[model samples]
Target: MTATSSPPAAASRLDHLGLLYRDAEEYAERCAAFLADGLAAGDPALVAVPGANGDLIRDRLGTGRAEVRFADMAVAGRNPGRIIPGVLLAFAAAHPGRRVRIIGEPIWPGRTGLEYPACAMHEALINVALARHDAIVLCPYDAARLPSDMVEDAWRTHPVMLDGAGRRASPAYGDPVATAADFDVPLPLPPAGAARLVFEGFPDLPGVRAFVAGWADAAGLPSVRRPDVLLAVNELATNTADYTGGPGTLLLWREDAVMVCQIDDQGHLDDPLAGRVPPADSVGRGRGVLVVNELADLVRIHRRPGGTSIRLHFDLGIPPPS
Candidate 1:
């Protein structure tokens, strides 16, 4: 999770935005018109709308670029993380050095900050994707619903514009989403072996840890990093069960520089950022996310129509199997 709040890295080549929309239809129509211009201008683009809003984008653009309905995002597709960012990354890759634009809503035009973490995740994923591309990226959203803090943060780095009605605004820029298509976070050589652990919902924590530790040992990984991995997964998996209930699946694998752990549950989160969110809790939930934020190098979350999924990527700097 490379939030806007995170300490500055080598200065990402990304842009942020804050839009104000009067209505969903107006928003969709104007977005379609803007994208049409962008396409004609020779930039590449990807469009995302609530499942129901696909028609709006399609009707306006008439199909030249790759488009994905937000409905396809599901817990089953957790291997590469949530569908939104993955689709955005894929679209950006297809264009290669061209601009990419993603529309935030489709079903019903709405306010951003009012929706919870999905909008935030939407922005964060786009930021990660835009880190180094020469392409332009655009996002249209309702400003009234957004928190002032988020709006301020997004406006700080991009060209924001107010819409036709005094009620709408958006960011216009050339930061493309293609940057992350080739994103490779460097890590140590992967374990000598790899295996997949499948489970239905959340298993008993102790049992899950034992399984993971045993598998890691067999994979020729160092024992020293085991507890960190084990505890992190346990706390997160437990958190998953507590929030999303007990009926889902989890997958583990290694790709490039990361040892990936993903958990899926049949929970269609209405609010996107509910899981990794900061909560003011004496019950420890807020603290748990804080810990996950501190320990994991990268954390991505997405929700499918039937459920929600979370993926955590751990860096490989620790010793080999101890």
Candidate 2:
């Protein structure tokens, strides 16, 4: 299928497209067509997919494919929560005024059950996050490899659907905020040997970091990853202190092959897109959550009427470099 030659009429709106392809060959062909259209239109373009897919597209695009910024989604989008700020919005924000086109494949056959909810939410929230941007984002789904339900969810998340048959508006499109709210399952309790801490005030930031590092070390988290875990914890704790004006509780534990950290505060995060999009200015409040999402292998948030709880996960098997 060929992509539209030009971006949609509304320069301030986001046009989210979902593509369902049956195989590698089909994916490569459709993606190449879509991205080629974007490149030919002189729009800033980006492709963030798994390494093999990136290679396939590059091979098809041939020389000068290097001009298209390419990122390995396996690494950049390891935590789906980070895709909006670290990948999508980062690209759009860099090229203000000009329309941008991106091919992002965040969901794949390899996504674990634990990671699916966050991935789904990320997909849904993309609509809300980029609502006012002049961007066209194409998200690809491996139809033969992924579950039917996942494909259905894609229809709900995206406003436009593209396949071999071409593009059309998705009748299944729903409010992204409501879609995100549907996945707000309660997080599990910390493990048996979990460590707990409570801190208040900006002065306690250091204490929070220290506490996280200490527990990370005890949990056998590699030295290299300890810093990331600490930074994520510090970001969460800082948000708690700054926004809630009260003490926040933190729990750390090693469950199976993952190290988990949960931060709780008396604050409700109403914006589903908070950490997913970068702040327009340096002083933006959601930057901390953005940092936390980037550092953690997986991050889950539960925000209710009374409070918010964010859980950060680091895989024990993926040790940091020496």
Candidate 3:
């Protein structure tokens, strides 16, 4: 990859670059070099990637590892919707006036089709969220292993692309908002065996939780993650009661490795950035959806003219088919 030019150090904007690496060696070398350059310049550097990849980068960094912060992307970015508020921006906020450098690989070869949309949307939204911050986020994609369409999507989401040929401006870069909406297509209907419940208003929240907890238990969801599933669904139900002013429907089912909890209501979410952005204040309102995003393994939303449907996925620790 070429030593690409970044925005001026004084500029208050994010330099979002997509790194298309062919193998693990290239991925580590490129990422470690980027972090090393930032450390040389006294910038706060962070590496958030899967454990095995982190190890590779750490090895490449060697003694320099001490200067770079590390986070397990598998845990922190399990829900792509949470990466913005919980990982990227949170790290930026911790350092007030300094320009931050981050290597965020939210999408990996292991990412499933069920989780790809959320991952794609998160990458696109990074442009919007860090537009005015003096930060550089380098996202790496495994071009050899990932789907060709996903590799194609890297161009749409990032303004800069780096690979064997070197860095270049992405003429295919599209509007961030439009890219997000393109993935908001309607979800498939729940299968016949899926369990469901209809809720009226706030008064029925307790029952909603019980219904979810019971179904999740029956589906053999790990006991440790049961509360997370319950809390996420309860938040969605509460939002329906508080905002929709109409009854809502809840669907529960198990699809191989994921337990799905979907909520449908007569609510319109015009803000594509909702739940993705942190609330204004710590003690203020509007944290329900944010909390849901932080807890679920994956989240998908389908908003229509008259209503919105939000589906949260909880991984059941089952390995995907090879």
User: Model 1, 284: alpha-carbon shift in Å?
Assistant: 33
lDDT per residue, candidate 1, 68-109, as tens digits? Answer: 333222221222233333455556566776556555431122
TM-score of 1: 0.42
Ordered from best to worst lDDT, the candidate numbers read: 3, 2, 1
Better of 2 and 3 by lDDT: 3
Q: Model 1, residue 12: displacement in angstroms?
A: 6.2
Clashes of each: 20, 0, 0
lDDT, each prediction: 0.50, 0.84, 0.87
Cand. 2 TM to true fold = 0.88
Ranking by TM-score: 3, 2, 1
Q: Write the per-residue lDDT of candidate 2 for residues 208-313, one digit (tens) a residue.
A: 8888877766667778787788888888888888888578889987767778889888887876676776656765456788788989999999875678889999
Q: What is the Cα-based TM-score of model 3?
A: 0.91
lDDT of 3 by residue, 56-154 (tens): 999999886898999999999988999999999999999999999999999998887878888998898888878778899999999999999999999
Alpha carbon lDDT of residue 55, candidate 3? 93
Candidate 1 residue 166 C-alpha distance from true site, Å: 8.9
Task: Using TM-score as the measure, name the better of candidate 1 and candidate 2.
Answer: 2
**Candidate 3 RMSD to the correct structure:** 5.9
